[model samples]
Target: MVRISEFQIKDVVNVADGKKLGNISDIDINLQTGKIEAIIISGTGKILSLFGKEEETVIPWKNILKIGEDVILVRFNEKNEFHIQEEE
Candidate 1:
């Protein structure tokens, strides 16, 4: 029984590339099923960002490998990912 607040503090690390995808900003859930559909990781301002906008990576629930105390391990592929960029 994990709380959603706990998830926001953990860092999301990709096992494939060992990239820190940032912390979780939001979650997508299936209202009908009462299950998580995806995890949204909002990127902090990087030194070099695309169009000066930060990116939000949406990782499917299936991609989540393990949920640890301090970090969440995920199997992420850069080429095949759903990203939602924040428009300023």
Candidate 2:
């Protein structure tokens, strides 16, 4: 188990395709199980916001590719294919 404080918000996340997803804004946890559940990311740019109006994206833990000292890399599911979800 790792402390969430070890990571920072607004850190960039990436995919295998080298596509920039966004920055991590928050993490979602399952209160019932007391387990880390998802990673929330805010959109990286303004163009995406104009189309989708994304506030943030909740990505499941299973999708995480790697967790580095300063950044987190993740892969989102096909069902929730968000180019970028921004935080307001």
Candidate 3:
């Protein structure tokens, strides 16, 4: 059983480019289904990062391939066109 605190400490990496995408800041869960729909990563590579990113990267759960002790491997688009679920 993985606790949310434990999940937060791991680095999120893109398997395609092996870029460290930062850590998990939050998770989007489908309350109706009681399942995680996506993981939100801290947006850090922006030029105006000190002012905070315009939007955080929300990676769909499907993109995640592996969860190791210290890192999470995900396969996402290089374009950064992450899929965000429509709000109700």
Candidate 4:
């Protein structure tokens, strides 16, 4: 079994655009069901800091295609669009 800590070190990549979405910074979990809801990626950029904007990329668990040894492959869908928004 793979531990959640293992995911923190693996790189997350998008198969649709071949974009490196960075590593897993955090995860959303459903306590009731004991299931992962999404993977959270921390944003990076100089401009983003200047604007006081810190957004995170949230990839739904359903979008994950495969979990490899070094990388996690994810598929992009309308419901899983990558975006930068203000962190709440």
- What's the lDDT for residue 76 in model 1? 94
The candidate that achieves the highest TM-score relative to the unseen native structure: 1
Every model's Cα RMSD, please? 2.5, 4.1, 4.5, 2.5
CA deviation > 4 Å runs, candidate 1: 46-52
State the lDDT of candidate 4 residue by residue for 1-88, as single tens digits: 9887999999999898898888888898999999999888877743435657676788889989999999999986535377556633
Candidates 1 and 4, the one with greater TM-score: 1
Residue range 1-88, candidate 3, lDDT tens digits:
9999998999999989999988998999998999999999865554444554344688889999999999999997947656333222
Worst 10 residues of 1 by lDDT: 45-54
Candidate 3 regions with alpha-carbon error over 4 angstroms: 45-54, 83-88
Clashing pairs in 3: none
* Candidate-wise lDDT, in order: 0.91, 0.67, 0.82, 0.83
Deviation of model 2 at 62, angstroms: 0.7
Candidate 1 clashing pairs?
none
TM-score for each candidate, following the candidate numbering: 0.86, 0.63, 0.80, 0.80
Off by over 4 Å in 2: 45-52, 77-88
Collision count of model 2: 4
Which candidate model has the greater TM-score, 1 or 3? 1
